[model samples]
Target: MEIVTGMKKITFGVFLLLLLSSFKLEASNYTFGVRIVGKGKPMILIPGLKGSADTYNDVVAHYKDHYTCYVITLAGFAGQPASAELNHPLKGQRDEIIRYIIEKRLHKPVLVGFSFGGTLAIWIASTRPDLIGALIELDGVPFDAGIEKNHVNMDSIRRDARFRNEKIIDAQADYWQHVDSVRHTKKFREQGFLDMKELVTDTTRINQILDWDDLSDYKASRLMVNEMNSLDLRDSVSKISSPILVLGSWKGWVNFKTKETVAARYQKQYSPADKVTIVFSENGKHFLMYDDFNWMIGEMDKFLKSI
Candidate 1:
């Protein structure tokens, strides 16, 4: 029965093909899991630190009708297993993302990053403007350090508060070891929830955030935070050729803080870019997407559709 044998071989081949496809989408060798949606130009959606794909659920629903959404959950975040390369997890993942873009042949794909993902998106576009079409950042700055530098100078901000007390290698590692060790305890979630409450206004969302944080690899998350603050994209912003739209929020800090003052910060950071627009939410917290959905959507739609 040659015909029957041939069918069996074809079936096995199809199964293997599907297996490989699943593995690829799993981002096994990379630093993120990609879930594709809709049918149009590629639009990558990156969430905040320790955030999962669910973070972009509403945003994806909004954009899917027009753009194909590639929802990426970074490695070691929200239950995704930590990648073997952990020392410089954030930068390492940037390279992986570039590889995915080129390999996937997603020419001039739009990048939408939220919070830390927004920063990562900036890094991606700055790294290769040739591969990106547009960048949409939600509450993600070009660089975030506690210092008030007259300009964007990474060298000057190198030893800020975070690193001032972080020179010792062994001690830092041991500290993170202890930090992650208590992940299963209620104290971990409670503490994380308390800090997140300041950023996320919604009580329900804060609870969800705590869950994601506990599932995320503590060392990896902290390493990413360290990497983000250490690097300055103010100079590299000139490298980006694609259009950028940055939507931020000001949680109304006391004393002489206007929307313009807040918006000026983003303007200063992205000053080197050729095509960029900055907008701020009148009354919203750090998670602009959720806190200021209508205004954010309007800004996003105008900026994106115009491009």
Candidate 2:
């Protein structure tokens, strides 16, 4: 009886150690705070503004067994110290990601972005085409629409900028809450419904916005503005040598009636059978990744497999 009890204790200790080891392995495996899984064609996934890399678990799980998946969380978004500032803008964030890929030596990975993330992916492809193998945009403006043209009005843009700035200071306000309010989190396994109030309390969100301040948006907005002001892709749709797939919500751009319309109208700019393929989902909204993830995943699968 004594021998049997000792053996049982030994087994239990081994089980505990194994469980701890497994947890450590999983945590340590995700180097660079980027969660990577599966095995096949390498694919890099970029999340929307203030989004988490972990949100892609469902989508990544579906394809990880067949494709290597890399989910990136922008520096400030994931509790990392903000090396940049509020006025730094989106271009800084994009360049940071571009440098990360180059430094990591990820070869020709399929570049996928959601919302603002889509904008980043497009910028990378446009600027660093050789680094990207295939481009997949989910519910975002595909090309750079000159900032002036895209904004409702200079007054509105400045007002919005001010509002955003104030929210950055509070960090616990619902600045980004409305973004996820319409999203479907049931399928996405999010931490919660992303209540605007709750979002203000979120440490990750607070730190990112506070650290980056207006820099991320300012830079991105201007880079896009310059692209529109000087180098317009309107005529060079055919020049985008990289394989591209664009996705949008079902209501098209009519639902927003204002700000979001620019996003929808841009789709028509591209020909259906052209190098770029535009797909619409009846159930998705600005946060299409959460609204209709299955549909998005299906399209991603089809696109990745084809190219």
Candidate 3:
């Protein structure tokens, strides 16, 4: 998935205020936190990297009347506490989500994940296919990007991931401040803004996203992504038995691939699954929720009702 980052005032400041205030955080023992709202059928919303529980404010606002929503904010993002004890934070997140479901008696809750959260949801569903209800992902999958795809040696990948993660953790203080320094630049900064423009149309949401990235526990978040990106889950998706709806964004890759090609790529990656529906946004970038809310939510609503 493409990532947009950094800060700029942008347009409509109050809208940003409204979204931030929607979630009331209650930290948990599971290296994550929850902001519960509404009542009835359970729904768990997971945000992307650097995302807070409030990232699902729009979805929560719409669904709170009918569904009991569990908006999750994982550690290392949105100023949530990051755990140092967990060897695998992504798995730590996945396992705890399963435990949270069992402990809370949220039987068959719908799982909605964005970006990295979507990747985690895939991990969660694949691990315990019987746990969650239906699965919905917004521009996220068990995709292994960044590292070369041709490398067949899994051990080498694991070692590389570990080294990169360790380097970040060692400098946990300044990891994200620069990627640290690697991504922190004037042109890079402009590109980040450009990314924001491409990914989301709502300026307030853009501002909110930058704050999330700014306050994010860069090392902790990178550790999780580093580990996640090392494993290719294209085939592993077959293990998930639940029905899935994936809304993908393809506008960013227009320079490199056609819409048909990008859509086909998403289909090919998710082809291992038995019951999966993949849809792409016509003009949206990565943040489909903010960029193409109407079309995105329409597809989501249809899927939710179908199951």
Candidate 4:
């Protein structure tokens, strides 16, 4: 009887191992750096410009036990080799994400995006609402008509593209020099561009940021931004039917007289959405996740639970 019981226990252990191996195999098929961790409901995390799958390390750590996180590192960013097929990165990224979700059989997975990633998330949810269950935008907004309102002419597009190309060249040349200067300095932290204080204090996060900075494809980044500058998505936002939670930053630098003005701006910007909830992080900067982590986690948890 003891020998029979031991054999049964060994068989169960082998079955568990095979199940875990199958899950890993399924996740490995994605071309993008899709790091799947933890367990339970599916959650997709898209990082900001020049960010990698690990960009949401803190957030993933917090929710790993409760959710299976699909952290994606886009082509040409986060040290991943640029895909030649991605001629138009913005649209290409959206399509790739949709394909990934379908291929993986992820049902109603919550989408979380930060910065440029958040903007892409909005595009995905607007265009393919069926693929996502809900969305959380962290310091990202739809296109503003004001940027291209005056530059509708072809000449303006040509000029802007040329200018951006030159800027990209300059950025590539000085990228490492800038990285070295900011790697251990306090000057960058003082500028408040990305809540650098939080970055500098966290060595792992700081190193990850710098690593991506060193390997980033500046030309691709600039090209995507230049193309995006010519498009507006106000109408697209109106078409989205999925529930959305937008957490915007209200730092006083963007010609805002008060926090109320900033809040009003975001509310008006996202008003077209039928089901949207907007919140502002008064004390946080662009990297709100790092600046107000506890608040972000609490809000995200609440939003996820509700959905």
Of 2 and 3, the candidate ranking higher by TM-score: 3
Of the two candidates 1 and 2, the one with more favorable lDDT, higher being better, is: 1
lDDT of 2 by residue, 1-307 (tens): 1223444644666767778999787544322247778998788898766566765767787888877898887654544333343543455666766776787688888888876677667767777877888888876554444422544343555566556554554553354454334332353224333432132434464444333332233233333333222333344444456889888763434335443554446665554314687777766555555556788888887887798
Q: What is the C-alpha lDDT of each candidate?
A: 0.80, 0.60, 0.80, 0.73
What lDDT tens digits, residue by residue, belong to model 4 across residues 1-307? 1223544644666777777999878655544578889998999999988788877888999989989999988777867766554336667878889988887799989999887888888888888887888989987777643321333565676577667656654665478466556644665443443554433344455555766855766556666666556555656888777789988776623545477766766777788999998887757655777677888778888887887
Error of 1 at 226 (Å): 1.3
RMSD of each: 3.7, 10.5, 10.9, 6.3
Least lDDT summed over 10 consecutive residues: which range in candidate 4? 143-152
lDDT of 1 at 42: 89
The CA lDDT at 228 in model 2 is 24
lDDT of 3: 0.80
Worst 10 residues of 1 by lDDT: 1-10
Query: How far is 244's C-alpha from truth in model 3 (Å)?
Result: 0.6
Ranking by TM-score: 1, 3, 4, 2
Off by over 4 Å in 3: 1-27, 146-156, 171-191
lDDT of 4: 0.73
Q: In candidate 4, residue 287 scores what lDDT?
A: 74
